[model samples]
Target: MSVISDNNDFSFKKNERLYHRNEIQELFKKGSSFYLYPFKVIYIADPFEAKVNPQQILISVPKRKFKKAPDRNFIKRQVREAYRQHKILIDPEKLNRNLRIAYIYTSDKKMPSDVLTKKLKKTLERLHQEFTV
Candidate 1:
């Protein structure tokens, strides 16, 4: 297991601040977002000078698709753990600019964890690359 210290702690725990629903809703309304699939990652960045940290990330696997709460929770857990373990995607080096990101899963079914990890890694890499540019 890897320790995600410093800028790599993706858990967004109590010590790390986060954005609120109203803010997200407002961003959604404004639509300054980006999407990469296996999911649609909706991000609303402050069009300002720079950002020291990612405000927050929300993961969604639609309840309408999974239907079973437990199943949905399981997938959500997997996604969060993956992000927690590998948050270089949200690295502050990249955050020399500002951003607020939301990950919304559009898939309609559950896949194994291994498969999910691979996809997540790809998405994170893409986000990292995009973040810098």
Candidate 2:
């Protein structure tokens, strides 16, 4: 794991968010996936080619599982927060590729923030292992 020397490294910036419709579709079509309890993580590592960020991510809480807008929003917030805190676990320099990742909330019920964070941290650590290999 690479050390995050500056506090600014923790910020989740706008460019780090993956929101383009085509890119999202392509991710679902081509990315590899794994289920980690509450989340279904899908990811693609593309050759580096002038990407704005080494890593970009999408977070989704399906409306079918979480009918209310607020519930979906809250879950998304928690997932994003957890990912933001632990993202450094995946070292971009080691991977040498741009990664596009999606964290799809798979659980039917809401999880406590602490539990969610722990799960996400484990998920990220697993991803790091995969990418490095």
Candidate 3:
């Protein structure tokens, strides 16, 4: 992950989250994906005429895999926290276009927070390499 000198750069604001239904559907329908253990990452790069955050992300923990609401919520929280901390790894300026990404939790078992953070770091690193190329 790339280091940011300013601490405020780490915040995960509402605008940085991908939550609209239409956007979610488009990302899943048209995006390319890769699996990295617990996360199935789908992403697309598209230019937008209107100014927007360079990247926005959606995180999902399936109901089928996690039968209870709390379990699903817990995983989502972990994923979101990890993303918020490590997002600086991807430099938005270099992307030069809007990037939409979805992270679907695929593992049936809940992962420890430390392991989840490590995996998320690797996932973001991979994404950084993919876009920077």
Identify the candidate with maximal TM-score: 2
In model 2, the Cα lDDT at residue 39 comes to 87
If the candidates were sorted by their lDDT against the true structure, best first, what order would they fall in?
A: 2, 3, 1
Instruction: Report model 2's TM-score to 2 decimal places.
Output: 0.90
Ten-residue region with minimum lDDT total, candidate 3: 2-11
2 versus 3: better lDDT goes to: 2
Position 51, candidate 3: lDDT: 76
**lDDT of predicted model 2:** 0.89
Error of 1 at 91 (Å): 1.0
Please give each candidate's TM-score. Answer: 0.76, 0.90, 0.89
Which candidate's lDDT is highest?
2
Candidates in order have lDDT scores of: 0.67, 0.89, 0.88
Candidate 3 per-residue C-alpha lDDT over 1-133 given as tens digits, one digit per residue, 9 for 90 to 100: 9676654487788998998999999999999999999999999888643477678999999999999999999999999999998987876666566788899999999999999999999999998888778
TM-score pick, better of 1 and 2: 2
How many times do residue backbones clash in model 2? Answer: 0
Preferred candidate (lDDT higher): 1 or 2: 2
For model 2, the stretches where C-alpha displacement exceeds 4 angstroms are: 1-8
Taking the tens digit of each residue's C-alpha lDDT, what string does model 2 give over 21-122?
Answer: 999999999999999998899999987765457789999999999999999999999988988889888867667778899999999999999999999999
